[model samples]
Target chain A: MASIKDVAKEAGVSVATVSRVMNNRGYISKETRRKVEKAMEAIDYHPNQIARALQRSQSYFIGIIVPDSNHPFFSDLIKYVEMRANEKNYKLLICNSLEDPEKEANYISMLRQNQVDGIIMCSHTMNIESYKKVTFPIVSFDRFISPNIPCVGSDNFRGGELATEHLIQSGCKRLLHISGPLDLDILSNRRRDAFVITCMKYGVAYDIIEGAHNKLTFDYFWSFITEKLSPEELHKYDGIFCSNDIVAYALYIYAQQQGLQVPEQLKIIGYDNHSFTRMLQNPKLTTIMQPSDRIGSMLTNTLIQMIEAEEDDPHVNNTTVDVTLIKGDTT
Target chain B: MASIKDVAKEAGVSVATVSRVMNNRGYISKETRRKVEKAMEAIDYHPNQIARALQRSQSYFIGIIVPDSNHPFFSDLIKYVEMRANEKNYKLLICNSLEDPEKEANYISMLRQNQVDGIIMCSHTMNIESYKKVTFPIVSFDRFISPNIPCVGSDNFRGGELATEHLIQSGCKRLLHISGPLDLDILSNRRRDAFVITCMKYGVAYDIIEGAHNKLTFDYFWSFITEKLSPEELHKYDGIFCSNDIVAYALYIYAQQQGLQVPEQLKIIGYDNHSFTRMLQNPKLTTIMQPSDRIGSMLTNTLIQMIEAEEDDPHVNNTTVDVTLIKGDTT
Candidate 1:
C-alpha cells in the first residue's frame, strides 16, 4: 500500500505538506492541493480510510491522557488539542492521570474499551511494556512511547540552548535550572541535557533542581524554593532558567521577597512562555516560547491520520515544531 | 421514589450530605454515613442506578461544554471537574465552544445523540428554550438553564457585595468594576449587580466595563485596558473590582505601567482566587475566593446524580457554594 511518504515523494513536497493536503489543514494553496491530489492518484495512495472508519461506526471521539490539566503547560496543551479536535468535528475525552502509573494504565484500557477512534497520550506514565501492549492508534507528546507510536513535542534541546545561551550572554556567570521531574525519559529531558551541555560549552557554573510539579500547590513551590534559597544561598545564582513559567513566577516572587531586583540582581528565563505571561508577569519573563497551538493541531491531525490510515509510518509527519526565544522584562 | 431531599430529611442531614453518601465523596462522619444509609433504606431511595446505567450500556462519558478551556478559570474548572469525575470512573468529553452559539447547540445535540451519561454545561450560549428542549440529564455552571435543570455556581451576589464592601471599607470613594461580558444573563452577572447595589448603598461612585473574555488574548486585555485608562481617567478611580482574576491581573499590570501604586494609590479586588494566585501573583491579587475545587466536586456529583437517577429534581443538590475574601497586597 502506498504511504503518505509515497504521496509526498510523488508530489515533490514535504510529508507535512502531503499530510496537510490529506487532512485539509492549514492554508494549502490551490496549486499545492492540486499537485498533492495528482501525486496521490499517480502513486495509488491507499484507499481512503475515512470510508472504512465510517463503515466501522467511527466514535468520532479521541482520547487524550495528560498528567494534569491543572498544570498551566498541560492546560494549554489540552486547550490547543481540544480546539483542533473541535475543528475536525471530533470531541476529546480528557484524562488527567495525576502522574499515577495505575491511573494512566487504567485510562489507556478505558480508552481502548470505549472504542475511541484513536488516542493521544500527552501523559506517559504507564510502563513501556504497558504502552507497547496498547493496540489502539496512539500518539504521545514529549515521550517516545514506542518506535511505531509517534511522539509530538517542541524542539526542547533547541529551546534549552536558546534559554541557556541567552542567560549566559545576559552576563550571568552562575545559573540555576529548575525543571519538571527528571525521572521520566521523556523528550523534554533533552532540555536538561542541552542545559548541561550548553552550560559546559559556555563555561558557566550551574545547579539543577528537578521536582514533580503537577501535584504541588503554589504554596509548596514558594515555601520549598524559600527553604532551598537561604539568605546566603539566595544570592549564589545570578541567573535562573525554569522549565515552565509558573516556576519563573515563583522565582520572581522569591527574588522580590529577598530584595533581589530582577535582572539587576537576578535574571530569570522560563520555558513555554504561557499566554498569561504576555501581560501578567511584570518585567515580562524572558523565556522560550513553545508553539503549543501548532503542536496541538499537529497531534490531533496525526492521531486522526493514524486512525484513518491504520498505518504506523512515523515519518509521515515531522512531529517536532520549532521553539523561539521571547525577550521579556526578567532578563 | 424518595428524592435526595427526602433522604436528607430522614437522615437528619443536609441534601449535600446525602449526596456525599450516595456519591461516596468528601468527608462524612461514620455516624452520618450510617444515618444516611439507614435513611436511604427506610425511605426506599430509588434503586441503585449504577446497575441501570450498566444495563443500558453506560458510556461512562460526561460531556462538559465551556466557552474555552484555554481560559485559566475554565482550565481550572476543567481540572477540578475532571478530577472528581475520575474519582467516579467517568471520563470527561471536553468541548471548547469559543463562545459560538452554533457550536454550543451542535455540542448539545451531539452529546444527546451519543447517549452520554449526562452533560455538565459550563458554557451557556443557547436560548433558554433550546436548553429546555434538551432532554438529556444536564447541570450547568454559573448559568440557570431552566427551572428543572440544576445550576451549580458560587454566590455571586454575595461575592460582589463582599468585594465592593471591602473596597468601600478600604476608604475608596471612587471605584471601577471589570467583568466578563454582561450580555449573557448568567448567574455571575449577579456579581456586577451586587457591585452596583453595594456601591450605591455605600454612596460611592462606580463604573463597570464588561466584555467577552474567554476568546481574547492577554495582549488584547493589556492594550484595551491601557486605552481605557487615559492619563486623566487613570486617576479617577480610587478602587477597582474585577469579575475575575485575569482581569485583575490585567488591571494590575495597567496600574504598574501607569505608575499607580496598588492599595496605596488604587485598591483592586478580583474574584476567583485561582490555583496559581497563591504565589505566582505579585503582592498577590486581593480577590474573592470562589471554592472551585468544591464547585467542581459539586458539579460532577450533581451531573452524576442526574445521570444515575434519570431524574431531574432541582433540590437534589444545594448547588451554591460559599466565597471568601482573600486579602492580598493589591487591596
Candidate 2:
C-alpha cells in the first residue's frame, strides 16, 4: 500500500504539506493542491479513515441502540435511520441491547470507546443517571431520559384520542384496550392515559389489558386472544384498541374463528402502521400511522446538529411529531 | 484522558515498555505488567481503540450488507447476525444497499475504506467480478458470488421440495407458484427448480407468477391476486405455493375476501416461517421454515474464521444448512 510519504515524494511536497492538503486544515496554493491531488490519484492513495477520524476527533459514525431489529417497529425505524445516516456519509453501528440494562450500558461504553460521533438510543433500560452522565450527543426514541437528552417520538396522546374517538363514533359501546406493560417509563404511556381520559369523556366503559412483559411478542398476542379471552369473555366488548398492529392481527384471527362479525358486531383498531401489516388487506387493521421516515430524518438531523455544534450551547429540546389515523377495513 | 506516556511515567517505566505491555508483545515481567496495569487504572487511562486499530489493521467490525432492514426476511437475518457477531466481540456496521448496483458498489468500497474486519453479504446487486476483486474476507448469504467467496444459506432446494411434495400429498391437482424474479443468479432459484421437478414427478400441473420486480412488494402481491386474478382465472388451481410467508398471508386475505375457503377448497403454503407470521395462528400459515438463527451463526462464524485464520490457507468452502416444513392449518 502507498503511504502519504510516497504521495508527498511524488508531489514534491513535505509530509506536513501533504497532511494539510489531506485534512484541508491549512491554506494551500491551488497549484499545490492540484499537484497533491494528481499525485494521490496517480498512486491510488486512499486516505485512512481511522487515522483521519483520530486526528480530527470525528468518526463519521452513528451508534444505534435498539431493543431488537427483528421487531417490525424497530426494523422500520432502523431502516430509515440507516438510510439517512448513510446519505449523510455516516455509518451505523447497530447494538441490540435485547432490552437488558447491563447490555445497554456495555454497548454505550463500547460505542464511546469506538469514538462514534453520536448515538441514537431506541432502547432504554438503565436509569436517567446513566444517560445524564454521557457527555456525548444522544437522541432517544420513545423514552425520555433527562431534560438535557432530547427524545423523539410521535404524539401518543393525540394518537390515542383519534383511535378512541373514532371507535366511539363508529358505534362502539364498550372497548377493550390491550397494550404492553405500562410499568416502563416510556412515552407511549401517554396513549394509555389518553385512552382512559377519552373513554371517560365520552361516557363509555373501557378496560385495559397489559402484556406479560414490557415488550410486544407474537406469543403474548396469540395466547391472550386465543386462550385468555374465551368466547364468553370476548362477548363483553364490542370494540378493541390494540397497542400494535400485531395484536390487531391476532384479534382478527380470533374473531374469524369465533364467527364474530367485524364492523358489524366488533370493531378493531391498532397502532403503528407497519408495512408488514399490508398483507392483511382483506380486513386491514385500522391503525395510527407514525411517520417512520420523517422521525428518522429528524433524529439523525438533531444528533448531527448536536455533534457539530459547540458543547457549551444549550441542549436541543425534545420533539414529538404528528400521527394520523389510517382508516382500514376493520373499522 | 490520560495518555500511555502518563501511565508509563507513573509506573516508572519507559513508554516503549508500556506499549509492549499493552500490546502483549515480546515479553514482560509479571511485576512490570502489574505496575503498568495499576498505574493505568490509577490514572484512569482508556486505550485509544482508533490508534490501536490503525496499528493492528483490525477494526473488530463486520460490515452487513442487506437490501433493507425493514423487510421481514432481511430484518430477521440482521437480528440473528447482530446477536452472533456481538457475542464474538464484533460490532456490526449495517449497509442497506436497497438492491441498487451503484449503492452496493459504494457500500463495498466504504466498508473497505472503514477497514471492517470482514463483510457479510446479504444483498447482491453487483456482478460476481466486483466481489472477486475484493481481497478481504467475505461470507455471502443466499447468493453464490464465486468459489473463492464462501456462501451460507438454507437448503432452498430442499425447502422447495418439501413444500411441493406436501402440497401434492395433500391431493392437489393443480398448483400455483408465486416467487421473486428468477433472473437474478441467487441460490434460492434452486427452490424454483425443485418446485418444477416435484410438480412434474407428481404429474401435477404447476404455473408460476413472478414478481413484477426482483423483490417482493405488497403492491405486487396485492394487485395481482385481487385485481389481476379474476374469479374465473383463480378457479384453475387447488393449491398455491408462495415463495415467502408474506405472499402467503396476502393470499389468505384475498381468499377470505373472495369468500374462498382455505385448506378445504384451496390449500396454501408459504416459505420462510418468520416470527411476524406467528400472529397468523388461527388458521396458521403452513410454510417452509428456514433456520435464520443458524444461517446467521454460520455466516458470522465462517467470516470470523476467514478473518482470524491464515489468509494463505485454502478459502473456507460454502455451507448449506437444513430447512424444515412448518405444518399449520393452511395445509
Candidate 1, B198-271: lDDT as tens digits: 99898898888775555536676677677776767878999999887767787888788788888899999888
Task: Please provide TM-scores, in order, for all candidate models, with all chains considered together.
Answer: 0.81, 0.88
- The CAPRI classification for model 1 reads as acceptable
> Pick by lDDT: which candidate is best?
2
Clashes of each: 1, 0
lDDT of candidate 1 vs native?
A: 0.80
Write one digit per residue (lDDT tens) for candidate 2, span B21-90.
8766788999999999889868867786777789888888899998877777788888889999888878
After superposition, candidate 1 runs with Cα above 4 Å error: A1-57, A310-318, B1-57, B310-318
Candidate 1 chain B: worst-modelled 10 consecutive residues by lDDT: B47-56
Q: Give the DockQ (2 decimals) of all models.
A: 0.25, 0.57
How does residue B239 of candidate 2 score in lDDT? 93
